[model samples]
Target: MKFDNDFFNTEVREGFEISSMMKRAWAAQMEVFQVVSDICNRNGIRYFADFGTLLGAVRHKGMIPWDDDIDISLMRDEYNELIRILPGELPYGFVVAGMYADCERLQNAAFVPQLRVIADEELWDFNDYMKYFHGFPYQRAGIDIFPLDYISKDKEFADMQKQIIKLGMEILGKWNELNREGSLDKFVSEFGQLCNVNIELREDTKNYIWKLIDKVSSLCYRDEADYVSSMALWIDNDSYKMRKKCFDDVIEMPFENFVVKAPKNYDEVLKAEFGDYMIPVKGTADHTYPFYGHMEQELIKQIRRVGFKGSVDEFCEEVASGRLRV
Candidate 1:
C-alpha cells in the first residue's frame, strides 16, 4: 500500500497544505474502506459515501484536503446484516469497533451508535508507523459507518419516537457518568423511579438501553416509510432526514485511487444537506483536522520517557490496564 512521497505531500488547496502524515492516515482509512467494500460487495450489502465524505467525493473526487476521516452510511437492515457478519469476515488485525461491537479497547460507544472498522496491529515506532500504516494509536484510522433508519411518515409519531430516543440516550449518558463515579445504585433507583419500572441493575444496563433506543428508532420499516434519517443523528436533529429514494440506487464514483459507491441522486441529497454545496466551505469540520496528530505526539513523548521498546499494541494494552499513563 505504498504511495509516492509527492502524492502524500501534494497541496489540494492553496495555502492549505496536506502533509505527508495526514495523507498517510487517509491512505490507511481507504485501506480499511476497501476491505469493508469487498465484504459488502461479496455479500450483496449496500452502502454510500456519507456526510463530509460524500461532500468530498462530489467536490474533490477524493478526501477533502483538511478532512481526516471517512464516513459511510447503510440502510438499517443492511447495516444490521453487516454488523452481524463483519466480525468473522475481517482479515487478521482488523476488527469492528464502536456501538455494535462494543470493543473495550476503542470504548467509542458512549458517544454514537455508529460502527468503526479499525485496524489493530503492532508498530515498533510511532514515526515509522505514521509513515506507513498510520494506525499506531488504537482507534486512529478507521471508517465510520452510520445506519440510516426508516422514519415514520406520521409527523406526530416520528416526533414522539425522536423524543423517546433522545431521552434514552440522555439516560445512557447519565448511566455512564454515574458508573464512572461509582454511583450505579443511585442511577438505578432514579432511573426506576423515572420510568416507573422495577429496573434491575446489571452489568449490561447500558447495552440494554441502547437496544431499547434502537427498537424505538426503527419502528418504521424502510419499504413502508417515505423517508430515512441517520439512526445516530435523528435523536438530536431532524435535518438529516431525507427521502428514502435518495438512496434507491447507488452509482460508483471516483474517490482517491479507488472507485466508491454513492447514491445516484447525490445532487439532491447534497442540496438537502448543504444548500449550494458545490461552493467550498473550509475549516468547519465535525472533528479536529489531522485526527490523531496531537495524540500521536503525546504517545511518542510517553513512550520515550519510559524507554519503552514494545509494539504500539502492547503500549495501548499497558495504558488500558492502568500500568502506564498516556
Candidate 2:
C-alpha cells in the first residue's frame, strides 16, 4: 500500500514491528525458560516464577493471551547458581543471550534455529505469519528475570546499584566505541583493551538512582509492582483499576501468576515522571520507552515501563478516560 507521512504514522518503523518479531521473540523465550527450568530442576537451582509469568500461570494458565511478555525472579544466590551452571546446561538449541556476560556477538546467531536476542522486534522476517498476529514484543512478551536481593539497611545501597548500572552503561558506550570504529569484534575480544570511561566530566553528573533501586529491590520492595504498573496505567487511561485509588502496595495484586506489589508511593511517582498522567500523552504508546530505549531509540517512547494502571485504553480517547486514584 502506498503511504504518506500522515497515514504512515500508524505504522511502526523497521525495528519496532510487533507482529512478526514478537512471536519469534516469545517462542525463543519459552524455550529458554523451559530449558532453564529443566536445568535448574536437575542441577538443584531453585527458580520460582515471579511477577507476570507467575500471574499468567494463575490467570491465563499460560500467557495472558492479550499480553506478550514473561518474568521470573530468583533470589540472588539462586540466580548466581543458575548462572554458574548455565554454560553447560543449555538445551540443544538454547544458549545464553545476555549482553554483559555472554558472547560479544550472539554465539548462536548462526547456529540456533530459534534464539532470543533482545532487540527491536521489527528486524526479523515475519512474512508468512503477519495475518495471524495480534502484535508481539509489547512489554508483555519477553522474559524479564528480576533478581531478588536480600534486604540491606545501608541507605547508600541504592546509590551503589545506580553506580553499578551507570558504570555498566558507560562501559557499554566504550564497547560501542569499538563497534563505532568498525573495531567491535577486535575491542570486545581479549586483545581489544583500548578504552576509557571519560571519568573527569562524568564523575559528578551521573545520577545514583538505580543504586537506590537496587537497594530497594533487595527487599523486592513491597510495591515494586506499582513501580512498573502506575507508569504503564496512564497511557491507555481506560482500565477500571487504572482509574481506581492506588495503595502503595497494590503490587500485591494477582494479575496472572505471581503476587505483585507497588513501588513506593507509585501514584506520586508516576506524576513526577510523566506530567498529567491522564493526558493523551504523546509519543509511541508502549512500555519499553525512556528506560529500554536508553539502549536503542533516538528518542525515548517512555511507554509504561515502571508501573501500569489499566490495559491499553488509558491512552486512547475512544476508550473511557478515568482519573487516576493516587
Could you report the Cα RMSD, in angstroms, for every candidate shown?
6.2, 16.0
Lowest lDDT 10-residue stretch of candidate 1 = 122-131
Tens-digit lDDT track for model 2 on 1-326?
11121321222332333333333334445644555557766986555444345434444444433345555645455665665676676533344544222543443231211123232233333321221122222321224455544322343643343344343344344654755687544323322122222222232111222222233333434333222222112123312122112221324334322233333244443354344543322343235522233333321232254244344323221111122211
| Clash count of each predicted structure | 0, 52
lDDT per residue as tens, model 1, 1-326: 54554665546573578855566678878878988999999999999998889989999999877787899999988988998999788877677776566454444433466778876544224443343463334344678888888988788888777766777677776766867888877656554554455667775666656666666776788667888887667667777678999999999999887889999999987886778988887886876766775677776676778888886545644543356554
Each model's lDDT comes to 0.73, 0.37
lDDT top scorer: 1
After best superposition, candidate 2 residue 175: deviation in angstroms?
8.1
- Candidate 1 is scored at a TM of 0.80
- Best candidate per TM-score, number? 1
Q: How accurate is candidate 1 locally (lDDT)?
A: 0.73
Single out the weakest 10-residue window by summed lDDT for candidate 2: 317-326
